[model samples]
Target: MSGLEGCWSAPGQVRGKDATSVLRGEWHLGRRYFVLHLRSVAPAQAYEAAITYRAGEKPGGIGSFWMDTFGGLYEPSLGLGAVSPDGFYLDYHFPDAAYHNRFERRGKGWRWTIVERAPGKPDKLFARYELAPASCRGTTFTF
Candidate 1:
């Protein structure tokens, strides 16, 4: 029943070969639903988004809003993710782009591959990371 509520960080990030992102969140578990506010951090960039999930057998979907280096803001983006017993997939869609990604947990972290499909040719990307230490102390909340 672990959704997006906890203060989680991806300790490892690949360099130019991949995009690395870290996330922290404040989650509220309701009688039958859950909501989370998450922030992503990287070398020189940061963005925030909100996610909502309901109590169910499966991990629910997601929604996100973020800013880019181009001084552009993207909102109303819809997405979904699920972690299987041995693997995981995260899919995101924006106005002009769509991304499908799959990952498998490695020894201490996860290895990820993503396909960015746009109006033209689709591109494949790869990355690997070994979980690093996270300082999310006193940053987790549930209501």
Candidate 2:
């Protein structure tokens, strides 16, 4: 609730067959509200999303990510298991796979990475991100 706390947006395209252009909007650390807005570049199709984070005493918040397109429920968690000199760690879960999230800041933008981890197998999936300055960009402090 300290560093990456604000409204951020970016112009990005989802990797898929029915590719859709999206503008990711995030509201951090104030009232714990997060959202991702999407717009179809092919036409005038558009949708707005609102995701709320439930507060709890556990390492991660048990919640789900629902998209505006098809109303798919995604399991998302904000946990404290990740401890490093780089940044804070959290986990994002979907119906098919689970991902380990690392939010780290470098220069004017932040690099967010995700590693896929199944229930029984060792975590190995890797997805890297380099966010623009207009997005959430800053250093993370460790205790």
Off by over 4 Å in 1: 1-6, 11-21, 25-27, 31-43, 51-74, 81-83, 111-114, 126-133, 138-143
TM-score of 2: 0.48
| Per-residue error (Å), model 1, residue 66 | 8.0
Clashing residue pairs found in predicted model 2:
59-79, 60-78
Mind giving the per-residue lDDT tens digits that candidate 2 earns over 75-137? Answer: 233333433466556566665567776667766555656688777777774655455544334
Tens digits of per-residue lDDT for model 1, 50-81: 54443334544333333333334554444567
What C-alpha lDDT do the candidate models reach, one value each?
Answer: 0.48, 0.46
The runs of at least 3 residues in candidate 2 whose Cα sits more than 4 Å from the true structure, single-residue gaps closed, are 5-70, 73-85, 94-96, 119-122, 135-143
In terms of TM-score, the best-performing candidate is 1
Could you tell me every candidate's TM-score relative to the true structure? 0.52, 0.48
C-alpha displacement of 92 in model 1, angstroms? 1.9
The per-residue C-alpha lDDT of model 2 at residue 28 equals: 56
